[model samples]
Target: MAAVGWRGAPGARGLGGTWHPWGASGALSVGGAWAPVGCAWRPLGGGRLAPVGGARLPLRAPERLWGRARRKNPSDPNVEGKRRATIMKRVHMARKKGERIPVMFDEKGQPEGKHGDELMSWIGVLAQEHIPIWIQDWRSRDLDGLKDIIWKETITSFTADESFWTACIKSCGEAAQNFRHDLYKTFVEGFLKEESVWTRSQKVVDIYPNIEEEDWVKFVQYRTSSQFQQLSDRGSEIRTNNEYSSRGGRDGYRKLD
Candidate 1:
């Protein structure tokens, strides 16, 4: 808290003049004189300040008053989540009205704003809407089916033959694969290593209600197999030996300052 004093001439010092506090020093300029606040406004004959009879104001830093500084990038996860939801709502509304869906790409056939985040949001919504498709083992026919689904659902200016369409499918496939691995790691692998198989299975099913019991059982069996264990071990070894490290989090350079 800081105090402010009214500026008055020597003969009229401490009069009923209104006072205002400004700046970090709690000083205000009146006429040609600077009066330091947080004190009594006594005219020391030459505009010198003395501490007394002043009102205190609560001083707060900008960050404390306003909370975290906003990130500039729209693609930042905090911002992009709302943006994606809004786009999804527009898509639904356009469908209901029997109109062409809102497009993410510009007239020049390039994606608007942050393309990487846009593509991820599209595939993320697609995966969420079509959960059953993601749970299955994909074959060539399945990939083609997913490609068709992406082409129909995602509103982009890119044509069917364009590389951008293929890139969408590829990105979606990678995201789906990562999603499954993350699910397994978070739900299954998180159980105590020493716990019995039955106990772990029951606990996993209890904690992760979204996954069907049958699917969980099958997934557990596959993950526990010798082939899967060997692959996991190989991957661990490779990662352990790797010398390279990322400079930032999963978003990497896309993460805003």
Candidate 2:
């Protein structure tokens, strides 16, 4: 990660030959006569040729030059980390290559918004039922609270079986608004609004015996906001539009654009 420069031409006269330490020995050839002499020589590790007293060095080592080119540019590390994470997430979760998911379209062969209503309805149900449970889950650090609330609410309201709830949370991508999109957003916004609940709950659990409530809340909020709903929406839009465009629909691109 470090580069050093030295000062002269290789195999040239007066300190321009291969020099070694230990005895501070140097080799020089004058008029085809070779000679060895002892001197103080420090090996400048980076591939540069240095003059004995004051000579301009020439850059060497093709590998080092290429490595410098590949090194990441100095800028915002946070932005770089987020971008790298996003790419890895997509690659890890992507479906099999060359395998296509069927497209749903209207009779006119235009891509229809098939899942928007279903997605919105799911969001509404989640906003009403799941949100409260999620809040309580944060407040109480209770998995049972989330389970009981989701069961009572989604089951009774929609008459959905266990399969529905399981499927909803599992394949969040299938939901109309994409659970990743809606749920992550809701969680981030909710956490921002009521971060003290999470912090206090964690404190009560003795997870971090000495963590200050305000400091804990601030830390959690920072992480949550960095990977929130808007990112999910952006990712989903890109994915859905790409899928639609592959099916020959300009409409999807238009809508997403």
Candidate 3:
């Protein structure tokens, strides 16, 4: 372990950390972040940072530390991927010549519109080719991504309408069957509805992964940090306060975000 210090950052005069070359390595404990242990040194401006005040910044170190300080967070592009996956979770398998129709049925367990005919046409092709195994073949790559593929392509696309429900159920290859359950009809229908399942999941932003509250406390506690000082100026920005309803003590929100 070696102590690395920084005095170039304004008002962070004596900030430093003990870098462990071996053993568990992660964010620094003070107002800065540490790069993962054993990042091979790269040339300045190409990897983590350019030369700073006659010093070459350690790769990924700035991003771990102060790059988080004044970041302008744009929307995550991957959310679009998730949203797209949800919309097509099941319909693409039934596509013919590029257009798709989901295995969606109305509440009455009847195939709605021309979906019955479309299912027959798609299934007819699959049956003629004897390619039920193709489903498994298409799914086997990128094991980490399989959950999304299965969710959007199989389970999320189950149609309860009896007219072609049998075809959809039988069309799945064994690999897909491993993750599915249909203990009851209504449970299947509710989960398959576009609005009822994936859309609701998409709206959630789990702060645990993104907000390192323990790490944040370090920066806030370093009172001499100019970056922390900047955050202090914005601390009182108007925000919603949670309140309870008088009649039943039921909880609700007054969202300001």
Return the lDDT, model 2, position 73.
26
TM-score, predicted candidate 2 vs. hidden true structure: 0.23
TM-score of each: 0.46, 0.23, 0.17
Tens digits of lDDT, candidate 2, 121-236: 33233432343312311323454555466455434333234544543342221221232233334334455566354554632334223335664455345446645447647766
Model-by-model lDDT, in order? 0.47, 0.36, 0.33
Highest TM-score against the true fold, candidate: 1
Model 3 TM-score is 0.17
| RMSD (Å) per prediction | 15.6, 22.1, 23.2
User: RMSD, model 1, all Cα superposed?
Assistant: 15.6
Task: Please report, as a residue range, the 10-residue window in candidate 2 with the lowest summed lDDT.
Answer: 245-254
lDDT of 1 at 238: 83
Cα deviation in Å at residue 53, candidate 2? 97
TM-score-best of 2 and 3: 2
RMSD of 2: 22.1
